[model samples]
Target: MLFTYPIAATADNWVSTTLLELLKNAVEYLQNAQEPDGFQESVPEEYQAEFARGTKFPDLYAAFVDQCRLLNDQQRDLVLKALAGQNGFPGLFAANTPCPNITVTLQAVNQATRSLFEYAFGKLSDLKTPGSVDTVRARYHQLVHSHIASGCCPFCGLEILEAPDPDLVDPDLDHYLAISKYPFAGANLRNLTAMGTTCNRSYKGAKDILLNELNQKVDCIDPYGDQLITISLAGTVLLPGGGQGPAWVLSFDPDALSQNWRRIFKLETRLQANVLEKQYQTWLESCVKYAQKNGIDISLKEGAIEAVRKFRDTCEYETFPAIARLKTNFFELVEAELNDPQDGDRMHNFVAAVQAA
Candidate 1:
């Protein structure tokens, strides 16, 4: 996938200033709700009484607030560091800091944070009101549609343009670190990212991106970081039973994290869908049409290579980048065949047959 710009740097602009103010207010509210022995009283009376009643988990709220209060300045800084997409904080917190002895589960803290996040941002319907604060979901939708993604899902490079509704059009925000697992980072800006709903809800549901099998934090490529993932077509083979010309196998460099990313998103399998194959076939047909219109004889090796190169270059900035990369790599394979003296004649004949078809 193409690299993503830093989200933390840009997130502040989209998030309403009122939301930050509300967060500070919520913190104060939590602090006031706590008693001397780390138990909470009922919530403030200003909120709707029924809503306030639901929030009154005295011990759980107290434990969550106490955990935050117990953090030293350095540890607090680490919290901010994790929010900025840096590594080391998760592991440090898990290993060094022990949860206080209270009836609070980490899941409770996560749920509380999520509730606070929603309250501060307001509801989705509230976002349409003139001066109401923008919800986190709304801000993330804006970030995805206007900045990171356009006509398709950025993570899978699939054209998800079937719906016209803004909510349906916009991709889902997958918490890169599962919010259920990392409660402290639930509202951290950098942890949120736009992904296809299928990838987020179906394939990568609640999976931990930061932690390893040993439960130690291992660094994965943050989509918001400067690192770029390169997807290429590894090879193609004609399958005896398939109707299509050949099945292309895609590969990625920097395989460690890239492979993990692929597995998490099910990218290879997603890209191999019948619709995508049809799209690829259509793209190939366009190249042949262009060659014919320009009076270029693609029956020759050099001519076929030139036509493929032109098509590949044209697709570089298109909406579906995965297709562009695949096409580029496919052309490179053709170029290799043309350069080999032994295979050159056979490759030329293959092109002639494709052109005639």
Candidate 2:
């Protein structure tokens, strides 16, 4: 996935205003209701009665208060820091200190915040309407769209259209950390990413990218961080019993988190023959056309090399990355053939076919 640009801090940004406001409100509203032991039993009579009524508001408030009471000053600050987009609290556990119950507090906060956010901004389901405005969601959407020049889903590298009609929905805002599993991160702006509907819903539903085979928690690459996992086209291989001639495969560096991302997202499998062939064909046609127009011999190799480099550079910003990487790998293979005397005929036949097509 392409790295997402970090959201700049501004006075009017949602994190500085809406999120902080909600958090402060939550703390204040629940303050009087919180007992020394962090239970509602010793609270005022009205609050006790409200809790006894079994309403969600009182329950959520109690959970928030209880979690806060359990945390030390430092831990609480960590949560605040995370909320402010300065750090990632849950990801901290992947490193040195393990805060197991932090998730509990975060979950409570997420549940309460979602209810409060929806109350203020209207229901999330109704966001498709042109008139509907959720400040938080809107800001996140704008941040993503503005940052990603390719205008494609970072995960799948598929084109994400900005509909001319305001009523039409854009890409889905995927919670990088699933809200169901990591509720505390639910409202964290850094955890939200804009992705295509298929990548967000179909392939990556509720799966934890932060865990390993042993179910132990590990840190997933933060798409907004300075450090990002790089992806490259590994090689092309012929399927065992295939109608398609060859398919390109992808490979990542030795980083475990990157590997986990590939496995969880099924990157290699998703970009198989059917998905990449069109892109490969396009690259080939472009190269052939360039050679013919320039009156350059396709067999001389310089035109082919130059064409591939130009296409790869342009694809880096203009096309879907999966297709772009496919082009890179395809040209590399062609270059390898050109360099080998025995493979010259194979390369010539390939170029001839591309020209004919």
Candidate 3:
């Protein structure tokens, strides 16, 4: 939720709008059907639209309606209406918001709509013209690369963010409100953005952020919205769980949003492995070098004590956000330890660790 990329700032993507138009047409036809099974295999000439110049939108929407054939007239209409709305993403994702509680009777509709949208999603990348500069994918790449300046993923700030490279791998376009759980948002770019492979696969995969498995609901911060989080060292503990040297206590702003974000991404656990464990010793070594370069004398206990402030002063100021976040919390912990008489054990431990390196 601390992610800074603004999805709301971006205009409606033309390609997404075009795909959405097809979805609207398909859903409207089903909603207007005189009976649940009255629809034809293909649409009428006027209702047909080309997804791209040569690719037909296909005779697929009727197949989804077929899945819902056992449903009554009112149930069928409820299912179709669920598929038609896409503009609710912004409000639905905002803090304290709850998705409409569709009952189990509408389950067939949910499955059918999800299937239809995902089928459409497969063609999104091809919605562009050959070598056309004025295309949605090109614009998406430009905006993403520009806004995600550190090249770090907004989801966890733990990996590089890049546009799709033909010779290499492409980043996953993650739906903030995952399509598996929500009916209306599968193709909406407002509900979608780039995500790191680890964040997408290992952490937030197919999990319903809005309503967990226990059926509890909470509002999640929009990845593209302005509600941002900051990292800080709340405190440090010596011999955490009676085994470790030290461990970080992290916090985020706007208390309401942090809980769900933390839960979904497992921020603390991953940051510990990827950032803290990996970087702690290197940061300590850098502090020692800083002390040596600045001629901060550390020959005696008091002299070594004098170097804590200088050590804390040299935390890395890099473009990578996770590194920057680590430095902020790590150095603050070091300074706080040195300032406390009760924390002399950690203070001396830090001095020994850095100076030894």
Candidate 4:
């Protein structure tokens, strides 16, 4: 991730809490098989009518109830272990860590445990209760606008996250934890975050942060966490024997996080293709113009070096029309190229081009 997402009073665990409460009720409903009553009351109040047997909406919980009655002793135990276990979906997502994944599968009870939460997760929109997805989204809008950089994705500052408004379409709430492959965090606000369309769907789609493709255990990052990772340009790598064009090198700090992040989102490759490769020379031109406007003569290598550093300092925060980290690092690259005598005045000639324009 590029920067940490701010968890405000707005980004509550309302959806998550509601899901867990339903799961808890499910655990008890299965345990007291002596009488299979009170199953209707276990459902969230807003969607209770829908869950009732002869309702306009389908009785989604009816199958679960029937399955619970037919549970063998071992299956009943599986329900308890999965829903009631300390390290179950509730606990693992509550902490939002990748290690110590919930080992108990919901299939332990032939998916009798799955219906309750999944059904309720869908109904969070109709919830008049304070915890509706609408209430959360409204709050998220406020929190995002106030706390995070405007139109910036906390995952990667490169993409644009449209400013959400009530009348217009909403942003995509990306699940930090892969709820599709792993169970539990589907509706949890803790697991949810707003990301760019490309970031959410294209790159970070359903890739389990907790487990790699080989099913190896990996570390996870909290979507609403405070830990910030650094994306820096280490330097440029030139092609051997010289005519193919220089290759860019990006460095991400706190290597462990970088490895998993890069693996999940293909962060380095995306930045190289989308931002660096396409924008490098254009960005250099902007930097030159910015420095020239500020009365710094960028024609000289010394002046160009000063321009790079000064422009970098201005990009410390992600503001409109500029990716803070990208500009900062690109300038760092410019400064590096300015200092390197081997490139035969690569950036110098680039600066000369800007001056001519």
| Model 1 alpha-carbon miss at residue 321, Å | 1.2
The lDDT of each candidate is: 0.54, 0.55, 0.63, 0.61
Q: How far does residue 275 in candidate 2 sit from its true spot (Å)?
A: 3.5
Candidate 1 Cα errors over 4 Å, as ranges? 5-10, 13-136, 149-151, 160-170, 212-217, 234-249, 273-282
Regions of candidate 4 where Cα sits further than 4 Å from its true position: 9-15, 43-58, 84-116, 130-134, 238-241, 291-295, 317-322, 337-350, 353-357
Q: For candidate 4, what is the TM-score?
A: 0.79
Candidate 2 Cα outliers beyond 4 Å, as residue runs: 9-134, 161-165, 235-244, 297-317
Winning model by lDDT: 3
Over the full model, what C-alpha lDDT does candidate 2 score relative to the true structure? 0.55
For model 4, residues 1-357, the per-residue Cα lDDT tens digits are 666556673245554565456555654666765454354565577645434532322343455556655766666565545433322432343324432223354343334334444544454444433434455456665677667656677666766676666576656777666654444455565556778787788888878766666776555555566656877667666322355555777777777755776777878887788777787667767787898799988778788778878887887664733356777766666677778888638767766777788
lDDT of 1 at 269: 80
What's the CA error at residue 313 for candidate 4, in Å? 2.8
| Candidate 2 local lDDT, residue 267 | 74
For residues 1-357, what per-residue lDDT tens digits would candidate 1 score against the true structure? 455634643354222233323333434544555434322223233333323333433444454455556544554343333323322333332423332211133334345544444442333323332343554456555555555544566567654522335545545656676655444444445556666677678887887665545654444665666567887666665232345456677677776666556766777787777434666556667778888988887877788877766766776666566666666666666666656797766666665666778
Clashes of each: 0, 1, 1, 0
lDDT of 3 by residue, 152-247 (tens): 788788788765466656577787777876756776667777788988988888877776446677777767777778776676563364546666
The C-alpha TM-scores of every prediction are 0.66, 0.67, 0.81, 0.79
Name the runs in model 3 displaced over 4 angstroms: 8-12, 18-56, 65-71, 84-87, 94-96, 101-104, 129-135, 163-166, 238-244, 300-316, 341-349
Candidate 2: tens digits of C-alpha lDDT, residues 122-220: 223222222235444555566567777777777767657463245878667676766555454554555666677888788778887666657766666
